[model samples]
Target: MEYPLAAANACLNAITTVALIGGRVAIARGNREAHKRWMLSAVCLSGVFLVCYVMHHAQHGSVKFIGPDGARGIYFLILAPHIVLAASLVVLVPKLLWHSFRGNFDAHRRTASWTWPIWMIVSVSGVIVYVMNYLLWR
Candidate 1:
């Protein structure tokens, strides 16, 4: 059976969120190795999510937001930023990872400080969009 791609994407987003939080906590505790592991896992999960997301959209086209006017505005409010960051991550994430892997801690930290919140927002708002478009409004 064909699974619901939106739901699958949401699950990936949640997984990425948990990994991101874990990575952040690891770093905050000064556990560099643990932070690296968790953040790498997040990157891998997000990479998978991107592939699936693109495939789903390619196959199914856009899933329109359907709801009351107020809800529609709210949905776009969340979606617009999510989309912009999501696109930015295609470059930002790889650059962040490269800095980490190259032992450039200062550069890594600098970029990660910016990348983290944006990534969190994109991951979380993805689930919010899924819920609003698929579950709540369905």
Candidate 2:
């Protein structure tokens, strides 16, 4: 049976967003270990999501957006940035993890300072895209 991959991808995006928030909170509270665990989980989930997303789209091709004029424009506005940052995270996230694993806290922190917000926005906007495309707009 074919899986509902788009919905699944959206769920994964939500999970990654939660993990990102948790990691941020963990570090803010001085819980390095928790931060590491949560961030790593976010990275792993995102990796899986990317694979599933690529496969689904490979099989199914693009799913066009259908909505009212204003909403459609807004969707593209959110989607544009989300796509850009999601691509950036493909590199930034792994680099951020590598720095942390290598005990380069200073570098890690510097990169993460930028990575966190972008990642959060991408993850959240991903879900918004899914909702706009598959749920609300559909």
Candidate 3:
């Protein structure tokens, strides 16, 4: 009954988190090209993760937490924001990318200031959720 896809998704999230961090660093260092590469990689990986996530959930449905009652609250707390922000990324990411693609650095940077943090939170929380659901809880 274990879904390997859950683990794969977790790995994807981890990589995406690294890519987002890399993008941030590249921009801070004024390496626009590197920033673009890192951000695009993060976007591509995120897209793949989204597809895989849907596939896994469609086949297996949602994974319920099996951890101790004390930790169940923590798991739900982590999961709720992850779900909400993850859904928002579908729109946020594309809008942020569009600004960059259109050569509007000012707007892009302004948007990214907020989008990046939210994306990072979702990516990191996703890995935490995966571990809690499949490893710790199980």
Candidate lDDT scores, in order, read 0.91, 0.92, 0.94
Instruction: Give me the candidate number with maximum TM-score.
Output: 3
Tens digit per residue, CA lDDT, model 2, 1-138: 243899889999999999999999999999999998999899999989999999889988988887888898899999999999999998998899799889999999999999999999999999999989888766
lDDT of 3: 0.94
**Which stretches of model 2 miss by more than 4 angstroms?**
1-3
2 versus 3: better TM-score goes to: 3
**Using alpha carbons, what is the TM-score of model 2?**
0.95
Q: What are the models' TM-scores?
A: 0.96, 0.95, 0.98
Off by over 4 Å in 3: none
Worst 10 residues of 1 by lDDT: 1-10
Q: For candidate 3, what is the total of clashing residue pairs?
A: 0
Candidate order (lDDT)? 3, 2, 1
Name the lDDT of candidate 2.
0.92
Q: On residues 1-138, what C-alpha lDDT tens digit does candidate 1 reach at each position?
A: 243877889999999999999999999999999998999899999988988998899988987877888899899999999999999999999999899889998999999999999999999999999989888767
